[model samples]
Target: MDTQKLTIRLPESDVQFIKRFAEEHKTTVTEMIRRYLKQLQAQHIDEADAALQSITGLLPQNITEADTRRLYADYMMDKHR
Candidate 1:
């Protein structure tokens, strides 16, 4: 995949820590940061999936199409008000 260059600024202490940790693992700081970000993204996906499961448990098991429409309309109206 194509990627663009990006620059960021962080504390000197944080940079030193990342550099040392990356050296220990034999990788660059950029790669370490990317891996950390991917792990966080996976964690967020897991949390969102759990929330969806909880919502499914709260909703009826056999909602008809009309019931779905009414529920959507009610939710929208309540949210707007």
Candidate 2:
């Protein structure tokens, strides 16, 4: 993979905080940022997969056409909360 250099500017206070955190963890600031991004992406993928599974399970297999439509409409309007 090809790598490019990019510079980012943060407030002095934010930089100090990140520097302290990275020092305590014995890791670089870049690694800490990368780990945080990966965690966020993983959480997003899991949520998307769960929503897809739930919607797929709602598909009708042996119901009449009219009943299927009604069921889907109700599912859309009904809030779990």
Per-residue lDDT of 1-81 in model 2, one digit per residue for the tens? Answer: 575676889999999999999999999988898899899999999999999988885655777989988987888889553
Question: What 10-residue stretch in candidate 1 is worst by lDDT?
Answer: 52-61
lDDT of 2: 0.88
In model 1, where do residues sit more than 4 Å from their true spots?
65-81
lDDT of 1 by residue, 1-81 (tens): 676787989999998998998999899987877889999999999999999888876767898889999999999999999
CA lDDT scores, all candidates in order: 0.90, 0.88
Q: How does residue 45 of candidate 1 score in lDDT?
A: 100
Model 2 misplacement above 4 A: 61-81
Candidate 2 residue pairs in backbone clash: none
Which TM-score value belongs to model 1? 0.69
